[model samples]
Target chain A: MAKGPNVNWLPVKDDNRPVNLDLTKFHFPLPAITSILHRISGVLIFVGTAVLMWLLAESLSSEEGFQRVGEWLQSPIVKFIVWGILSGLLYHLIAGLRHLLMDAGIGETLEGGRRGAVLIIVFSVISILIAGVWVW
Target chain B: MVSRVSGATNLGRNGLHDWVLQRFSAIVLAIYTLGLLGWFAVNPDFSYGAWRGLFDATWMKIATLAAIIALCAHAWIGMWTIATDYLTSLALGKAATFVRLLFQAGCVILIFTYLVWGVQILWGL
Candidate 1:
């Protein structure tokens, strides 16, 4: 340890906080859970973006290519996958908007944060459902 | 030496710089997403001809290229944060740093590929 100059400080006490935490056992607050879901949706969007990119490319290749891409998307599994991606995207967008609001000092309080989280989840669910309808 | 000196990760270097980058990119990406959603709302049951025509426009092409670049920058910071948050020493023990580097490397490659492929798709003959 590096030596401190001038006045002497008191000795530090032993830290007893759990080092390896079991996340599932711990209860998280609404805002914390929303934050976690934001990350989760972000990661999901990351993978989905790649899939979307390919679809974009293939659809733009030719008229036949576009029709073929649409045909393959007729499968329920593919529709579900695309819906999942859209769901992730919708949730992520709403959550991200909340983050931007926080950045602008709009909803930085605890009460504000909780309300914001509820709003995020509610709006995201509504958007995701609408996306599901459109996709189907 | 610089990482040790500044206490910064080597991937994107500075925390504040990365924060600003992510914010700016986020705004661009958010607008692009909203724009696409609005287009879909307006163009229900849009045909291949309409879709191709939309992309064929110079302005839309420029907009897409800009969004692709923003996506790369935005995604890099997001993934880097995720890697550092979860793949740290507390979670992965001694090999966490190594694993993080590998993960970040993959993210960089994938993001860059997306940028190039997006350009190809946007402007390809």
Candidate 2:
């Protein structure tokens, strides 16, 4: 390792002049968008798992337990929550598959990543529609 | 690195496993979701015996079980990849590995619990 001072540890203001800091000039790229969405979907899955597990435990306890869960599903508010969870599951599944594909060297190129993002959107919409039908 | 032609397919390296598993799970979940919707549409009462009868069918039992298993496996693989990729520090990486092990174990327990429940319903246990 170099014995010189670490440039990365320096404050941004020390490294660059205030006049040069033009935030408006910067724009988010496609890859950044996709990456952000991936993290979002991951969080969604984490939250959804908690809710789904509760439903599973309740439904399996007894016949009345099953009925209670079934009744919750019938309510519009509960249905909305279920639909939201399903949507999260659906998007996370698709985006995750994309990341796996990328890791396997499938979508490493710029064009490939763009296409993968498009595919994610398409899959998400289709799954959401299915959830809508199931819920409503 | 020299690429040799051993010809034994590297399914994991080529992402075939991920692709196939993901789509396979998706298909299972799709069918399961649709069937559950139908159950609600046709028999909304959701009585004790009615719920039992639904899961008692050979196809429903198999399908639901399969869906649960596939969903868990698919989610496990996905989460493991994310945790490994992001947590860069060696210590954090090891922590993530431990977490992944817990995740896989938990998923197995989940599937086992569901299977036991389903069997008890079918076999009067």
The most accurate candidate by DockQ is 1
Model 1 lDDT per residue over B24-115, tens place? 88899999999999998999878999999999999999999999999988888898788876876656766767788788889889988998
Backbone clash numbers for all candidates listed: 0, 0
- True-vs-predicted CA distance for residue A18, candidate 1, Å: 6.7
True contacts kept of 1: 0.52
Individual DockQ of the candidates? Answer: 0.45, 0.11
lDDT of 2: 0.63
Residue A53 miss distance in model 2 (angstroms): 5.0
Task: For residues B25-63, write the lDDT of model 2, one tens digit per residue.
Answer: 756765676677677778854577776676667887677
User: Please, what are the lDDT tens digits per residue for candidate 1 over residues A13-111?
Assistant: 344433435677678999998999999999999889999999999989999989988997888998999999999988988999889989999989989
Candidate 2 interface RMSD, angstroms, 1 decimal: 5.7
